[model samples]
Target: MPTLSKLVCAALTCLAVQLPAHADNTDGSFQTAPSFSWWSGDKSANNNATGGGGVFGGRSLSVDGLINSAKNLIGLPYRAGGTSPTSGFDCSGFVQYVFKHAANVDLPRTSRDMAQVGQSVSRDNLRPGDMVFFAHTRGGGNRISHVGVYVGEGHFIHSPSTGKTIQINSMDSGYWSSKFVTARRVTD
Candidate 1:
């Protein structure tokens, strides 16, 4: 006894409700946040507006924001000793710029100083926001001569060279992996 239009409306409503929430429009794939809730309980209380507290609090947000901001500058031209996007940037300059803008963390001008500022961490234990140092074109037993931000999953973002643009490179890549020196974690 229901009208045809009413029947179609009811069916559509049921379908809509049954569809999973957070489904991507492009492919209708369901997406979920990683279970790790970086911020919780006491940690949340300690993370003031200034972004203090350890990695468990707003620090994670800082890392994520920094990574996102770094990714946004994928094609920026590399300029030696340049810090701002307007002037372009060198490797350390690019890292400093991203951290300053995204996490409000000011880093030293040179890669060597930047490496000295943070706590040393092993490559196997590196987390997001950690710094990865390398010798670049240097040969054996040489000190670290380059640095990049570890954005996670064995990948890093940096201003590679004079003519190269700011971009992500795989840590597993022979060129990079062979040159990799060490990793450091500046923030908790």
Candidate 2:
């Protein structure tokens, strides 16, 4: 009998060969990617890594790899609309780039459009790979100008502003709390 690890590996291998480069966009509607929740499960697996437990078994990589990749850019200068380390990044650009490279998930380019790509989720229910939006410098009811990746533990990773570096921030902080607009789950 195939073990759970073997089954997961076989499934992912089949998915890798069968899944299309882009997710389905039928009926002029976008659906959240079915593999989005894999990020949270990856994190849990890594956190449980103890005594060579082999928590991570399949070809699917861990979210810690994604988070660590993002963390490597901490202190990188911010640039408007930037998407690479050499150029720096805006909030949404940072999220898009990180997910694309680290998790191979393609996201919309702009913050507003990206907000619409995921399922609406409250901040209380946010998990890894979820997107958190904020008003940032924007004011009034038309909030939602900045975006970030929720990396767990009430913290999010984002490219804040010009002259600022990409960094992790607490959602509970007063500045973020006041500016936070909404959170969305783009993955399963």
Candidate 3:
């Protein structure tokens, strides 16, 4: 029997023409091409396949790649309106940058606006690329005040606030759990 890698390669070869032109995105990153569709009943939705690993007929969305890219920015400082690695990133800016580069999806600039783009996902059902939202109860109430990328295993990465750098935090922690508002899945 052929190995799983070989089977996957053969399948990708057959589907190459149907895949989008990502020749410039060869560095283990993905770009959004709506032609890409998820396989039905995906058991690996959270698998984090490195080489565009979750598309129809072949690897198409690299959850692992997106996560890794986000991880690489762990020490960057936070700025209110920052968006790039050099200028530092705010909560939403960080999420937008990662999805745009690592996953090839352009998200809205603010966390509140970002919350509106994707489908609602319960905390229990979160996958790796799901955007998690939180609210500051004092001033936020039901309004979203923060956002992060759910990196799986109950952990998420974000630029918490001023004087803080991008860091990963737990979804189950008292602070985040209490403030949790909702989550959205913008990637497959």
Candidate 4:
């Protein structure tokens, strides 16, 4: 009988072989460059959830990096229409700055406008770095008025209203949960 180590390696190798096609080049070429080297190789250091081998954007910034960058602003005063760490940030301003810095992606100035783009993601399907939206109306409305970056585990980071600072809050909070709208994945 085969040893357990060999059997496990064989199983992972089979699973890795089923991965779908990947974009070939920087411009997303269709060329197929094939490899499953990670399967049989040492995986002791692999911890990335996406299974891309811990590579963030493969050279661009990773979502974790974006979360870290956003988290660094915690305690920065909230400023309406503000866009920089120095000037502080509103909800949208904070989102804009973090996306620009982390992924080189430019988001709209206001939360509502930012909601228009990107793939629509359900709140239940939220992933780290995904954008969560909200409306000011107590009962919730179609108009989105606030935004935050979902940092996984039902929490998000944002520069809340006046008198608040950039902070992370549980989306499951009574107030937020009631006003919660759909989420979007700009990084996807």
Taken over the whole model, the C-alpha lDDT of each candidate is 0.68, 0.66, 0.72, 0.70
Two-way TM-score contest, 3 vs 4, winner: 3
C-alpha TM-score for every candidate:
0.67, 0.66, 0.70, 0.68
lDDT, candidate 4, 135-181, per-residue tens: 87556566799999886656677887898777666678545777787
Q: How accurate is candidate 4 locally (lDDT)?
A: 0.70
Worst 10 contiguous positions by lDDT, candidate 2: 27-36
Which whole-number lDDT from 0 to 100 does residue 2 have in model 1?
A: 100
Q: In candidate 2, what are the lDDT values of residues 1-188, reduced to their tens digit?
A: 99999999668555543444245333211122122333334434333123222122232334565665676576687898798999889888898888778667778898888888757999887766678898866346755799987767676778888877786666775467677888876454
Q: In angstroms, how far off is 34's CA in candidate 2? A: 30
In each prediction, how many residue pairs overlap at the backbone (N, C-alpha, C within less than 3 A)? 0, 1, 3, 0
RMSD of candidate 1 to true structure, Å: 12.1
lDDT of 1 at 152: 61
Report lDDT (Cα) of residue 150, candidate 1: 82
Cα-based lDDT at residue 177, candidate 2 = 68
Local accuracy of candidate 3 as per-residue lDDT tens digits, 83-129 = 99999998999999998887567778998999898589998988777
Q: How does model 2 fare in lDDT?
A: 0.66
- Candidate 1 residues 39-122, lDDT tens each? 112343222223632342234336666655776676688898888888898999998888778777778888988888768999
Top TM-score: which candidate number? 3
RMSD of 2: 14.6
